[model samples]
Target: MSLVVRPSPAIWVDGEPATALPIPDRGLDFGDGLFETLLVRQGQPVLLDYHLQRLQHGIEALAFPDCLPRARDHLASACKQLIGTPWAALRLTVTRGAGPRGYAPPERVVPRTIITSAPLQQDRDELSAPITLGWAEVAWSIQPRLAGIKHLNRLEQVLAANEARALGVDEVVMLDARGLVCSVSAANLFLVEDGRLLTPSLEYVGIAGTRRRLVIEQLAPALNIEVVQRDVHAAQLEQAAELFCCNAIRGLQPVSRLGEQHWQDHPVCSALHAGYREAVAC
Candidate 1:
């Protein structure tokens, strides 16, 4: 995994026309940053407001900056450059900015915002059957203070994903230190049992994914389903009627296999996928 953004792809840093960063930047030094990956369709980003709001909340929570207005302008400018492309993936990263060579941050903070857009492959399959998932032996740590923040420190995910790949699984389910279902290596989890929606409460760990929030706040109500956010243990998922993973970039991933368990065409998954697409269209 190279950190280099390709020259072919459009990239901008802090409204500047460049692709490099300072070596001493806190983002590179300490993983002190936030990022949002958004899906751009036919030039326009879907649910742009939702994505921006999450990043804004994170920026404020991290006490980084009030850079949303300029960030939005930069994003708009980047999107405009790709307006004719069929599809693109946009990534926006904001770091606490460069600082002195110590743990103490600068008294005055200047955030560094990086925006990148790259054309998406035109022929990926989104309608394929549900993907296979496996349980990762590595457990995620419980950091309630950073829960749902989407911070840049993702070594845990990198290790988990590597293990899943080595095991020939498309994705891995991660458990928190307390043996509760946290999420997939890169996305949030949702389970359906007896026509109800269930997901782990991010109060303890895991990110509050953009798509996950939208599903709870909009799609679930539109589909007339009861949504529950509470502690989810690994044993609790054993008999689930349906399971799916979600994030902004990969909208929805229906789970077809987890160890010996299997399922197909779960009505709730289909309904929610339909509702989710429609909701994003608005």
Candidate 2:
């Protein structure tokens, strides 16, 4: 049997529930869109400003500058609609709206925005548990133009996620085409080495995750650790004292193994995780 995919349940669109975009939409045709996955706390988005900034930055990168108006108010209001859930995962998506055939967009553009919210599952608490990981045979593409934006083109991650499942690892550390460590399938990769926090630079590959940004600037200082951005390789993974992955929803998760490597809970990883939680909870 083959697997079937379904669109996410729509929560709001152009001020209507269950609304869907037209077929010729650019986002559907060419991945001409950007999105943010947010964690809702007590019906409010955490790190909301950062999420919007990233989304706006992504929009501008895609040549739709100022295509999105102030989205914070609309996003917060959408979250309020899910107040009964208390904790939810909200996905906000923006497409270059609709247009006629051909790569060239219409002289005028009208952007389409979609927001969906669902109750965050309890199993996500397992993120605190140190999980297994492995390297993916699939490598991320080096697209400098598209680098660092949470754009709609995610075929790489989808492949990486499948590789992780087939390899029976909780996550996969993806490499760039140059074999430099970029990120895990679903989140940003971080390793603690010699008392400093290190993660891959998103200069040429990978998305600049909102939580990763927070960790580099805010979480590291709170944990009293120096953070560095540079190319990391599998060889460097062996030198890491502790390992973790982070995202807006899971916040941060410790890694115990990547292939043959094994790690125990370290003070630095624990401290950083606590700091991450405090930052998100606040």
Candidate 3:
């Protein structure tokens, strides 16, 4: 794939406006980085702390130098430019800066932080609409060490998203190497069964989404809904009483159809979505 660089006014590198990253940058060359995509509401990044916490975990796991403070400051500066905008998408990326021509790390590392912002395209009505999901042909490889963090190595998600597009579904349910359901291409999956809410365990694969955590720890609990983390099989989708997917940007989206099975009028999902909107409202 040829790399196409487009100039954007919303890009910030090391707390300054810039259009391009240096050649040989580790993020570009080897995907040696971590990123967080946050929903910007009223010019502020929602769930900022959760995103940062995940990034910190990724940094520690990757043995990268501490750069969260710098990344945070850059993100704040970038967000300030979106003050009048009602909604936007913010991405904060941290990479082990340009290095010599090998996998060996430089004795001293200076991580690069890039912050970018774009207007959020999905409207409230669009986000509240029910969507369809298909099974992904691409299976997630089990990598426990990198399981829960949002690292830049997303080729698996990229492929799954392409498959979803081809299949004419809003998203695709990805399975781990063992054929256990993990998550959707870009969100966390939740299954409602027997009046209990269940989500796939991220111990072996998938990103531990901030929205997923919020739903499990706050929204569901507030409504007295039981939330369980376990190995959910693909077959369970057919039997689920209700199904939903969530991410920081889109909040909670109920699934209307998955293959031949169909769902309607998800009361639990509706309540949870209302709770999420209330929690994140500016």
The clash numbers for all candidates, in the given order, read 0, 0, 0
TM-score of every prediction relative to native? 0.93, 0.93, 0.95
Better of 1 and 2 by TM-score: 1
Residue pairs whose backbone atoms clash in candidate 1 = none
State the RMSD for candidate 1. Answer: 3.4
Global fold similarity of model 2 (TM-score): 0.93
lDDT of 3 by residue, 197-246 (tens): 99999999999999999999889999999999999999998899999999
Candidate that beats the other on TM-score, 1 or 3, i.e. the better one: 3
The residue pairs that clash in candidate 2, if any, are: none
Candidate 2 accuracy as lDDT: 0.83
Candidate 1 per-residue lDDT, tens place, 69-144, comes to 8888888888888777777889988898899988678999888889888887642224335878899888899987
User: Which scores better on TM-score, 2 or 3?
Assistant: 3
Off by over 4 Å in 1: 1-7, 122-128
Off by over 4 Å in 2: 1-10, 123-127
TM-score of 3: 0.95
Model 1 poorest ten-residue lDDT run: 120-129
Q: Taking the tens digit of each residue's C-alpha lDDT, what string does model 2 give over 190-249?
A: 988888888999989999998899888887887578999998987888679988898888
